[model samples]
Target: MYIHSTDVNRTLQSAISNLIGMYYNSTAAKPGIDYPEIPEWPHGYVPIPLHTVIRKTDFVRLLTFVLNAYELKKKNVAGKLMFPC
Candidate 1:
């Protein structure tokens, strides 16, 4: 899935926007947990930037999901979604 910077940025922004809007009508301006340079992270925590989080394999997986989402013959498989061949 080799996602570029723009796609990653868009995804992050959209996810953050949705999360922020979940319980409040107002939005706050702040950097998210995606920023990994911050010190004193939570215990047993290892932070990675959002752009790096979604790797090539993840992109491929997401592509499969996207394709599967539109598959007419798709069926539930152990609570998992699959694409039709």
Candidate 2:
């Protein structure tokens, strides 16, 4: 499902938390040895595609672009980043 929300911390958190609650008992939420099962991430949580505002529609669109050194070269390119620094 294409999960959407307003591009902001509050809305994003609400969407994520809701998805977690919705799929908490499902296998999709179950951690795997290579995927969400790694020690770096939380157990029982799977990565779901959470889309926000569409590009060219709002200022948040700019912030949504993935930001990294290579992405900073191509344009910062990961969800883990917030700014281009």
| Best-fitting candidate, scored by TM-score | 2
Worst 10 residues of 2 by lDDT: 61-70
Give candidate 2's whole-model lDDT. Answer: 0.65
Per-model TM-score, in order, reads 0.30, 0.50
TM-score of 2: 0.50
Provide backbone clash counts, one per model: 0, 10
State the weakest 10-residue window (summed lDDT) of model 1.
23-32
Please, what are the lDDT tens digits per residue for candidate 1 over residues 1-85?
Answer: 1323334666667655554455232123223443333455433232223343445466655776678676644456464654544
lDDT of each: 0.46, 0.65
lDDT of 2 by residue, 1-85 (tens): 8887877798899989998887665454545642455667766666679987655675555455533344556553546555444
